[model samples]
Target: MTIILAHRGSAGTHPENTMESFVAAEQFGADGIELDVHLTLDGDIAVIHDTTVDRTTDGNGRVTDFTMEELKKFKANYHYKHFFKKTARIPSLKEVFEWMKGNNLICNIELKNNELPYEGLEEKVISLIKEYKYEKRIVISSFNHYSLVYIVNNWPEIETAPLYSDLLYKPWEYANSLNSKGIHPKLKSVSDTIIKTTMENGISVRPYTVNKERDIKRLLQINCSAIITDFPEKAVKLKRK
Candidate 1:
């Protein structure tokens, strides 16, 4: 069966990377949630996608320039003001972890450090997973394969996946080389052949941003390990039916 992972917590229906969105994903019966994490000025793990808050929040600056206290000031729901009545704020990784204690959703935590080079990000995320005892429920992923490699070397108990947008010649072999349990590739890069071949070699293939009904049905029909989508509600319905 294919598991549905809400991309940034039902981003199509709610604010991306906010607590409200995450809660909604769980309510919609998604098997898991996928989110991104960036380091704040005070070294806290802030769970927003972009390097800057300008796009997602009312604030105009880099996420790394603000302390967690400062980052909390900006409403993280700038994009969906018309759709939702309540205000949403950026959530820390700790806060999200605390919320996870109330449920059993597998979390795919993507490290947003490929561009900025956030020092100690891997350590910080791994430490929190250990602190919360969420080792079995977490999957650490990154576009920066080096970070994934570091996690594989230092924290083999936790699972790590390589996130790529481009086509790799043989991703399964690459994943094996990095000791990764899965590969999270762009939706276009995934074909039925890729899904079958990759999983046959003992590696899971999870595509990102898969929201189309046709695509969702196809992946589910083929028994994809999981799909990260903006609309978990729709995907869940299709999977169940």
Candidate 2:
């Protein structure tokens, strides 16, 4: 079956990356939840997709500029009235892990690029994964090849996937060099030849942000391991049809 990965936790219907969204994804029968992580000023991991809180939340300034305690004051989305009729706050990574403890769902954790160099961020993430004993269920991904390579080299037991964009330099070679288990290309950047070559090289290809039924079917026809989508319900229906 084509795995339905809920991009930022059924983001189309719920607030992205909040506990509510994650739980909603579970209720909606999504196979996995994909969320982004950024380290706060106080050495805490915050579950957010961007470097700043201005766009997604009611707060301003960069995520790295605030302490976790301060970040708790900000809401995850200002437009979540349709789902819960109330505001939701950003969730911590540990809180998310606790929520996923017994659920039969995988967690796709994307480590967002760093704004300031932090020592041992990768180690910290790996430690948390070990602490949760989620080695089998968690997949770490990053657009930063350095971070991805660091995880690949130091934590070989953990699966890693590199997020590729149109600007990637020799994308295949980079993925191959890092020994990534999978390659997550932007939906538009993916092609039949790329998928075929990636598979031939023993690397799985899973495209991101694909919501349309025709695109989902096309990717499946190319043997994509998964399709990360905002509307997982629609993707699931498409898969069934």
Candidate 3:
């Protein structure tokens, strides 16, 4: 069976990366929740998808410019404020881990340092994972392959996967070179044949942002390792059927 990982926590219906969203995803029966993290000026790991708060929040500044305390002041619900009655706030990685203590859902934390190159991000994330004793329940992914490499070299117990959007030649081989346990690619960049070959080589393949009904059914039919989608409720129902 294919696992359904809520993309940014059922982002199609919730303020992305908020605790409200993550909780809703777990209730929706997702096997896991995928989120992004950036280091704040205060050295706290804040869970958000963009380097700038302008798109997701009412604030207009770089995420790194604000301390976690300042970042939480802005409602993280700008994207879905009209739909949700209560305002959502940006959750710290520690807060998320605390919430995870009560659930069995896996977490795929994508290090959002590809563009900004956040110093010590891997160390901070690994430290938190260790602190929470979630070493077996977390998968750290990143577009910055170097960050993944750093995790692979320093903390091999923590699983890692490389995230890429462009076409690559024999990605499983590339993952093997990085000592990554999986590959997270753009949906269009994969096929059943590619997924099978990659898994055969001992690398899991999980495509991102997959929401369409037909696409979800196809992946489930072929038993793709997992899919990161904005519609976990719909995908979980499809899988159940």
lDDT for position 134 in model 2: 93
Q: Write the per-residue lDDT of candidate 1 for residues 1-241, one digit (tens) a residue.
A: 8989999999999999999999999999999999999999999999999999999998999999999999999989987898887999999999999999999999999999899999999899999999999999999899999999999999899999999998787889999999999999999987789888999999998999899999999999999999999999999999989
Worst 10 residues of 1 by lDDT: 76-85
- Regions of model 1 farther than 4 Å from truth: none
TM-score of each: 0.99, 0.93, 0.98
Candidate 1's TM-score: 0.99
Query: Which pairs clash inside model 3?
Result: none
lDDT of 3 by residue, 1-241 (tens): 7889999998999999999999999999999999999999999999999999999998999999999999999989976777897989999999999999999999999999899989888889999999999999999999999989888899999999999998888989999999999999999998788988998898999999899999999999888999999999999999999
Better of 2 and 3 by lDDT: 3
lDDT of 2 by residue, 1-241 (tens): 5788999998988889898888888888889999998889999999988888988888899998999889989988775655566688888899999988769898999988745555667887889999999999988888787888888888899999998777454456767889888888898887778777777777777789998878988876766788899888888777777
Clashes of each: 0, 0, 0
**Which segments of model 2 are wrong by more than 4 Å?**
82-84, 114-116, 167-172
Q: What C-alpha lDDT do the candidate models reach, one value each?
A: 0.94, 0.84, 0.93
